[model samples]
Target: MVKKGRPDKRSKTRSQAAGGGGGALPSGELIGPFDRTLLYLAVFLTGAAIMMIEVLGTRILGPFYGVGLFVWSSLISVTLIALALGYYLGGIAADRAKRFQLSHGIALAALATALIPVFKTPVLLQTNALGVRAGAFTSALLLFSVPLTLLAMVGPRVIKLCTSRLESVGRSAGSVYAFSTVGSVLGTLVLGFFLLPMMGTRTILYGVSVGLLVLAAVLALYERARRNTLGLLVLPFVSLAIAGLLFFLGGDRLPSTPGFTTVYEAQSIYGRVRVVDESERQIRWLLSDSSTIGAIDLRTGEPEFPYLYILEALPRFHPRGRSALLIGLGAGQLPKLLGRYGIETDSIEIDPEVARAAKDYFGFNHPGRLILGDARYEVRRLRKKYDFIIHDCFSRGVVPAHLLSVEMLQDLRSLLNDGGILALNFYGYAEGPQALPAAAVAKTIEAVFPFHRVFVSSLQTELTDHVFFASTEPVEFKADKVDIAPSPLGKLMLDNLFRYEHKISSDQGFVITDDFNPLDSMQVRKAEIYRHQVLSDISADLLAR
Candidate 1:
C-alpha cells in the first residue's frame, strides 16, 4: 500500500506523462492531455466541494444541534474519519477497476456533490425523528457522511487513473493534492465571508449544487454524447426548479405549540443568530452563537436585568461606581442597563454581524463606544480603570477560556477601581434537581478575588449555576431597589417570563481559571436538569404552531 505523504508508482507515472518525459498521447487508446486536465479539474472541484459541504452541513445542522466546541469537535472528528476511510477505499478501488475505473469514481463524486442540498432537510428530519440524543452526532455522521466520504475518494482514484508513465506520478500526485488543497482553502474563505450572508442559504446551496451537477454532466457528455448525456444535462435544470420551488414556496416550520414565531434567522460567522419573538408578548429572545443572551420585552421597552439587580447591588455593596467595563454585549443588556443608571460603560461584543443584529433585531442600541474583538485581548490593551469590571462573556454551551483566565482577571483588576466589583455569570443546575459544577467557577472567582461576594440573581430555588459576583469591597448582599428592578406598575407590565427566578446561590467546589474550567464536567452533571430547563424554557409548546 502507498503511504499517505509519499507518492506511489502510479503518481510518478502521471508526473512523467505531464512533463513530456514519456512521449505524446498514443492516439485513441492512450489518455489524452485534455482528458488528464479535465480529470484533474474534476478532482480539484470535488475536493473543494467536499470541504464546503462540511462547512455548509455544519451551518445547516448547527442552529438545531448547536455549534459549540462539542459540536465542532464532533464534526471535525467525523470528517477526518471519513477521509481516512476514503483514502483506504480509493486505493483498494483503484487496484481493482482499471478500465472506466478512476474516471467513473471522480465523476460519481461530482454527481454526489450535486445531490447534497436536496437531501439536507430530509436527513435533518430523519435525525430529529430518531430522537437519539446520545448519538445525536453519530447519527449526523451516519446520514450525510456517505456522500461526503465518497466525495473524498476523487483524488486518489483520479491519480491512479491518469498515470501511464510510472516515473512522473510523484510530481503529478503532488500537483493534484496542491490544486485540491488550494481549492479547499479558497472555498472556505469565500463561502464563510461572502457567500453565506450575502447570497443566502438557498442560493449558496443551489449554486454549489448547480456547479457540481454541471461538472458531472460535462463528464457524461465527454464520455459519450448519448441520451444519458442529455439526461445528465437536464438534471441541473430539474434541480434548479426543485431548489427554486423549495426556496420560494418553502413552507413555514410549524412549532410544537403556538404563539412562538421565528421573526428573524440568519447564518453568521460566529454561529446562527435567531431572533424568536413571542407573539403573545413583545418579548424578543436573541440566540447568538446558539445561546440565549437576553430577552427584551418590547411592551415595557425596558431591559429586564435579572443580572442587573446583581450588578446594581455591586456599587451599593462596593460603592465605587467610577468606571464600568463589560464583555459579551448581547442586546447590550448589561451595558444598556448600566448606561440607564448614568454609569460609564465600555462594551465589547465579538461579532460585528452580531453588533448590527443587536441593533436591528435584538433592540440593543449601539453603546456610546462598542469595540469588536476578543474580550481577553481588549481587556489587556485597555489600561483604563473601572469601579465595577464585569466579565459577562458567555456563549452557548461553553464559555471562552480566555475570558476566565487568571491573567485576564488580573488584567481586569488592574483597570478596576480600588473598591471595584467584578461580576461573572455562570449557569449551573438551573434546570432543576441536579448536582452541578457551578461551584467550580465560584472557586475560580474566589481564587482571583478572594474577598468578593457571590449571589444568585433569581429566587435561588435549586443547585443551579447562577451569577457569582466578585467585588474588592465587601458586598452588603441585600437586594434593596436593585438598579434594574420593576416598579409595581412595571412589574405588572411584565410577561410571566420576566418573573421566572434565576439560580445564583451555590458554592461549587472547583472554579474556572486560566488552567482548569470543567464546563463539560458541569454539563454532564447537570444534563438532566438542563434538558428539563430547555424543555420548559424553549418548549415546543411556546413556539409557533
Candidate 2:
C-alpha cells in the first residue's frame, strides 16, 4: 500500500536517476503536457531543418560544381552517413549522460548551420581541384556533415526522452518518428515550391539558420524553467548572440567583375540567371549557372555565338520551308532571324527566366509563338507539323539526357512534315573520352532518321559544338538559295559552313533510350573539364555570388 503524503522510494530513485524529471507511470508518460509539446516541436523543427539544408546545399554548390549526378550523389551520401552516425552517437549519449538534453544538440546545430554561408566559398574553391567526383563529395562532407549530424541526433534523443517504460518503447518510437517524417515532407514541399523561387539562396539559408536558433532558444528556456535552474537562464541568450554574430560576419555580397557590369542577377527555379555586359567590347551575354547560353554584339545587334549563325543558316537546307519549330529558345535569336525571313516560327523554352532575360536584355522580339515548357513534353502536345525543327537545349556542359533518348527523337520525328528537317546542337570533343556523348547522340538521331549530316562549329577536332541535320529525305544545304542578309560574322560562318561538316561512327556509341541512358556517367569527365575551364575564365568570387 502507498503511504499518504509521501513519495514511493522506487519513484524517488527513478526521478533522481532521470536527472531532475519526475517518475513515469507504466504508460511511459514521463513528461508533462508542456514538456511533451516542447520535445515534439524540437524534433519537428530539426527534421525540417535537415531537409531544408539538403535542398539548399545543391544551390550553394551548383555554381561551382554543377547540379549534376555526381554532386547529387555526394550530397545524398553525406546526408545518410551523417544521420547514421548521429543516431548511433545520440542513442548512446541519451542513455549514459544524465545531464545531456535535447536543447544542447539543437543549440549546437544552430551554430553549425550559421557557419555554412560563412565558409562555403573557400571550402568549395579548395575542394574543386580534387576533380568532380571527389571534390563534390568532399565539399558536401565539410560543409554539411556537422549540422546534419547534430540535427539528426534530435530524433534519437526525442525517442529516448519520450519512452520511459520499456513496454511502451514501440509506441513512443513510432509517434516520434511520425512527427519527424511529416516535418520533413512539409519542409521539402515548402522549400522547393515556395521559398527557393521567392528568395535568394543566401537569404533562405539565413532564414533557416535564424529559425533553428529561435527554436533552440525556446527549447532551452523551457528546459531551464522546468529544472528551476536560475543560474542557466542566460544560456539561451548567449547562444543566440553567438549565432547572430556569426551570421553577421557571413553576409552575402555580389562580387564585382573587372571589365564587365552586371545588368541583372536573380535566382530562378532552374538556376542562377544573370545578364552581364562588356561595354568596352560592346557585347552582352545571358548566363545560366556556369554556362553562357546566349551572347549578342551590342554594336551590330546580332547574335555573337557562331553556333547561332549555323542554326540561322539551317533553313537554307530547306528552301521551300515556310513554317518552323525552334526548341530551346536561348536568346530568341534564331526565331527572331527566322521571323525576319517571313517564315512562321514556333519556339519552346523550358525556363521562364531565360525567356524574360531574352526579351528584357537581349532584344529578343520573336514574331512567332513562344511556348513556355519542356521540349520533351511540349513536342508531343503540338498538333501542327512544321517544315523545319531546331533543337538547341544543350547547356551547362551537359545535355538533358531525356531530350537525346531514342523515344524523344521518335517523338520529334513524328511532329515533322514529310520533307521536314530536324537540326540538333551539341557540345563535346569530336574524338576522345568526351566523344561518347556526341557519338551517342549521333547514333540516336540515326536510329530515327536515316538521312543526316553533322557539322562542327570549329575546324579543330577538340572540344566544340556540333550541329546535326536529320530528315527522311536527303539533308542538303543550298547556299545560293539563302537570301537573308548576314552580319559579317554570319557571312564568315556561312563561307566555311561545309568545311565544318564531320562524321562520328555509329559503332563508337550505343543508342540512348529513356529506359537505359548512361549519358550522365559517360560525360562526367567532359563535364569536369568544361567546369574547370569555366572556373578558370570567370572569377570564383563571381560564381559564388
Candidate 3:
C-alpha cells in the first residue's frame, strides 16, 4: 500500500516518540530537533507580541484620544475580530500548502511591528481628527489589525507543521496554545513592570523588531540549503530602512509656546508626565496624560489656579485649624499654601512620579506633607483628624468616580474634626448638559453633609472650576464684609467670592453612590465636546502663528 521512494509513517512515529529526534517529512524537507525547538519559540513569541501590542496600544493612543473606556473597548474588539479572521485564513493556507512554514508569518509580523513607529503619528492624528469613537476604532484597525492577524496565523500554521498524524492533532494544538498563553502572561508582567518604565515606547518596539528579525535569520539559516539566499541578504537592509523611516517621521510637532520649553518628560505606569516652562510669563506647567494638572507663576510664589483661592475663604468659617489634609497633590501648591498659613498639611498623591515631578519642577519640597498612594485607601487608613480636608483628585477632565461617591464623602467626614471644613474642587458646565456631572456630585455630597455651599471659580465662565465648601457648622461667604486685599492674586480671590451660590439638590437626577456610579458615562457627551474644543484650540493656535 506504500508508495515507492516515500518515507514510511514509522519514521514519523519514531521521531515524534523520541521527543526531539530527526522527523521525516511526508512532503520533502527534514526537521531536526533544533528545527522543532525553533517552531515552539516562534509560537511563544507570537503570542507574547500580541498581548504586548494590545497593552502598549493604550499608551500610544492615550495622549491624543485618552485611555478611557471607549479607546479600550475599541482596541479589544478590533484585536478579537482580527484574530478570528487570521485563524480561519491560516487553516485554509495550511491545507493548500505542501508544508507549513511559520518563519514567513513571524518575519511579516516583525516587519509590521517595525513599521508601527513610522506610521503612528500620521495615522493617529488623521484618525483622531475624525472624532474619538470613530478615531479610536479606525486607529486601532490601522495600527494593530494587520500585525495581530499575522501573529494569530502563526499558531495554526505551527500546529499544522508539528502534527504528523490525525491522532496527534489534539496534543499538537494544546501544546502550541499552552506555550502561547504562557508567553503572553510573561510579556504582560515583564513589559509593564520592567521594560515600559525603563525604555521609551519606540525603543521597546524596536527591540521587539530586532528579536523577531533574529528569530527569522536563524530560521532562514536552517533552510539556507533551499536557496533562499537573496531574501536573507535583503532582510538587514529592510530593517535599516524601517528604523530610518521612524527617525524621520516619529518626531512630535505641536504648536510652540512663545517662550516655553519642555523641562522634563517621562512615561510612568500612571501616564505621561511633562513639565514645561513659560519664561515670558514666568509660569511652569505640570501636565499629566496630556492635561494640565497645575501651573505656577514663578514671579509670585502663589498658586495661579483660581479655584485654589477657595482656601483663602476657609479660615472665615473654621478659624482655628491646626492641621489640614489635602488629597491629590497637584504640583503641591495647595499644601505649600497651607504650610504658609502655619497649618500642618498632609497630602496624598496616587502617582509617585507626579509627586516627584511636583517636587523637582514646582518646588513642592515641603517637609512631612507627601504621602504616596491612593487617596481613598490612605484617607480611610488615617487615624488622625484634620481641621480642613481638601478633595482635589482628578484624572484628565473628570474626578475619579471612586472619590466622588457618597461613601467616600462619609469617610471624609469621619476624618474631619468636630467643626472641620471640607473643600472640593470640581469642573463642569453651569447650565448645559455638562452641568449634570457637577449636579450629581453636589447631590452625593449633600447626601452625606447637610451643610454645603457652591462657589464658581469665575462668575463669567460657564464650564469651569466650581469649589464646594461643606462643614457641619454653618458656613458663610461674607464677600461684602471682608476687607478686599490689594495684591492681584488676592483681588482675583475676592472677585470670585461674589459668585458664591447655594448648592442645588439632585433629588430628581442621578446620585453617584459606590454601588451604582456611571461617572464616565455621564461625562461622555461633555468629553466629546471638550475633546473637539481642545483639538480646535490647538489647531487655531498653530494656524494663527
Runs of candidate 2 exceeding 4 Å displacement? 1-29, 231-233, 242-253, 278-282
Q: Which ranking of candidates, highest TM-score first?
A: 2, 3, 1
Top candidate when judged by TM-score against the true structure: 2
In candidate 3, position 430 carries an lDDT of 67
| After superposition, candidate 1 runs with Cα above 4 Å error | 1-33, 88-135, 168-171, 225-257, 280-282, 302-305, 430-436, 459-465, 477-518, 525-532, 539-545
Residue-pair clashes per candidate? 24, 0, 0
Model 1 per-residue lDDT at 4: 86
Q: What is the TM-score of each predicted model, taking all chains together?
A: 0.78, 0.91, 0.85
Tens-digit lDDT track for model 2 on 438-523?
89889899899999999888775377888999999998877688777765676788788888888888788878899999987887
Find the candidate with the highest lDDT and give its number: 2
Model 1 Cα lDDT, one tens digit per residue, 28-75: 134668878887887788777777777876665555555554456667
| Per-residue accuracy of model 3 over 1-545 as CA lDDT, tens digit each | 78999988987666553332121133433456775687888778878888888888877776667678778899999899989988987776665643334455667777888787677767876776577888888988998898899889877767766765556779989998999898899888888999887766666777777677677666656545444445543554465466547645655443355565667777787766767676767877776654568888878767777777766666556657768888998888876666655677889999777888998888887755678888889988999999999988875454588898888999999999988889998877767666878888888877878788888766675667778888887776544443434246755676557656535556534668889998888777666765665454333222111
Model 3 alpha-carbon miss at residue 97, Å? 5.6
| Runs off by more than 4 Å, candidate 3 | 1-36, 97-100, 223-260, 278-283, 298-302, 396-398, 477-487, 536-545
How far off is residue 48 in model 1, in Å?
1.8
What are the Cα lDDT values of the candidates? Answer: 0.60, 0.80, 0.73
